[model samples]
Target chain A: GAGVSQSPRYKVAKRGQDVALRCDPISGHVSLFWYQQALGQGPEFLTYFQNEAQLDKSGLPSDRFFAERPEGSVSTLKIQRTQQEDSAVYLCASSSHIDSPLHFGNGTRLTVT
Target chain B: SQKIEQNSEALNIQEGKTATLTCNYTNYSPAYLQWYRQDPGRGPVFLLLIRENEKEKRKERLKVTFDTTLKQSLFHITASQPADSATYLCALFKYGGSQGNLIFGKGTKLSVKP
Candidate 1:
């Protein structure tokens, strides 16, 4: 696909379990971002990467949430000891430039029961 | 802390009428504002962008106006149609040191009835 691609469209995890979400950004895109959207709410920023460098992770809810864009192409968001509050749609977006319009993937919906 | 607000309540309008959505912000002025449309179960798609220097920008039937002094932006859709019904999100572009992030409003759901 030409747009950003995300895997495991839906995931149901038991509380205290771990899960990892994957995102493949558009080819040659220099910027990638992760956002978490709760039901009926807008997406909240989680982290941002410029190629292989993780520039920002300020919006992450807690230390349990971590993300990495290894080799500057594919990225992964991992949650350890997931809690019920971790349930949300995780969205990934890519842009060719720092200030360009973002192209977003449909997103991965994670439910922690 | 910066805050963005959009009407949490849905906006109902008849087809063929014009639909206007408002977005307001406080605590900081942004360099630009972006509007996006999101359908059910889909990701947000970029609609229009208005810079601080430019008061208004238009593309096809979509128009966006930015008022830096007022810290508000208005999105207008002319000739509303059923297909135009969706949740519209307003984002403020905040620049800090070397990185920029978009702070988004909760979004306003627009319903165009035929």
Candidate 2:
């Protein structure tokens, strides 16, 4: 793809249900990132991947949140036992390199009821 | 604790005027700072980046100034137009941290009136 692509533009799940969001970054990009944005708030870091390596998962709010980029291209963010507080837009971004500007996806708006 | 603050109120300016937005941070040293523009229901688009060692940067009608000592950055849009109306965000890359760990301010919404 010419830019980062995210799937499931919007999702509504009941509390305690599990959900998965997908991201397909720009071709050959070396860095991929995941962020969660609440209404009226800036995007907050969730995880980062350098190719297939999960270099940082320090920002994940809890064990219920998990992300992986196994092949260094497509990534998935899965939330288990979702809570109402988990409702937010999940954004995916990729950069050509570690120091380059990021290209972001339109994001998936998740609403946990 | 580290904190980033941006103008809490929306800025309204007439077209052809210059729009200036402020971003301030505390309790952390950032290697670089960046500015982005976002529209409603859309993701933020990258604009400019300034390193700590650099004082300023410019791209076309956009100008960004970074002051590490004061932990502040100012973003200016010259000859603003109604189409330029959007939320501008300020992000900081922490020193010695991965780029994916960028910290962002809540952003300032700008409205340009014709």
Candidate 3:
């Protein structure tokens, strides 16, 4: 794809279940970001990866949230013991560098029942 | 605590009119501010960015003004069309912050009716 791509446009999981969302950034992009967007709210930063290095994960809300980009091309966000509050859209974005405008994926909507 | 705020209410305007949205931040001055447009069920698309030193920036039909003293930014869309309707978000990044530390406002939804 020409732009960032995310998998599993929609997912439903029962409370206490685990879920993993994937993101494929634009090839060669050096910066990738994960964000969570709740209903009627803006996307909140979750974690950021520079190439293969995970430089910042301060935005992750809880210890249950984890993300990784092993090869710097594809990334995954894993949520363990999901709760109803975890239901939201997970957005993935990439940029050529830290300061460049971001290209965003359509996002994956997760619903925890 | 740092906070970013955008108008919680939606704005409705007629086509051919201009629409304005407001974003305000408190406790910290960001090095740069950016505006993005998001349609329903879609991720936000980048629009414009203005640095702290720059007072204003413009594109084809969009203009953004940043006021450091007031800690606010205004986004304007001139000659609005129905196609321009969307939720507009303002994000802030401070210098020396991590690359993905951008903080976003809740966003203001704009509706342009023909």
Candidate 4:
């Protein structure tokens, strides 16, 4: 891909509904990251993967938030029992290496009603 | 706990003037800091990065300075243009944390009027 690509650019979910956001990172990107951005706020870290390994999940806010990168090229972030607080932009980023600058996707705007 | 802070207030400047944005951090010493430009409804694009040991860095009209002693960084855009109007963010890698986990400030919005 030319850059990181995310699907379902906008999502509206009801309370208690489950939603999944997908990210297709640049070809051969070695690292992937997920972030959550609230209105008027900077993106906050959610999770990270190096290749197929889930190296970090410490940033996830709660148990309802889950992310996976099975094949290491595409990733998915799933939220279960969504709440109003979950309404925000879900951002996906990828990098060639640990210290490289990240390339970001436009992100999926999730609105939990 | 590590914390990053950017001026919450918006900055307005006339075109052709230099626009400077500040970022400060507390309770952590980052090895590197990065600057990003974000437009409304879009993801942030990487702009620049300065290491703790480097006093300053420049890329065309963009200059970034890092002062580890003061835990501060300044991003300046020389000859600012209205196209530069956007929220500027500062981020750092969390020490002892995930390599890809970056701590970001809320960001400062800069508006350049022609």
The number of the candidate with the highest lDDT is: 3
DockQ of each: 0.67, 0.70, 0.73, 0.69
Alpha-carbon deviation at B53 in model 4, angstroms = 1.1
Q: What TM-score does model 2 achieve against the real structure?
A: 0.96
Score each candidate by Cα lDDT: 0.90, 0.91, 0.93, 0.92
Model 2 C-alpha lDDT per residue in residues B1-104, reported as the tens digit of each score: 57899966589999999999999999877888989998988889999999999999999999999988888999999999999999999998874574365888
Report the candidate with higher lDDT, 2 versus 4: 4
Write the number of the candidate with greater DockQ, choosing between 2 and 4. Answer: 2
Q: How high is the TM-score of chain A in model 3?
A: 0.98
> For candidate 4, what is the DockQ-based docking class?
medium
Tell me the docking grade of candidate 1: medium
lDDT of 2 by residue, A71-92 (tens): 9999999999999999999999
Stretches > 4 Å off in candidate 3:
none
Candidate 3 chain B lDDT trough over 10 residues, lowest sum: B93-102
The candidate maximizing DockQ is: 3
TM-score (C-alpha, index-matched) for candidate 3: 0.96
Candidate 4, lDDT over the whole model: 0.92
Which one wins by TM-score: 1 or 2? 1
Error of 2 at A45 (Å): 0.6
Score candidate 1 by TM-score against the native. 0.97
Interface RMSD of 2: 1.6
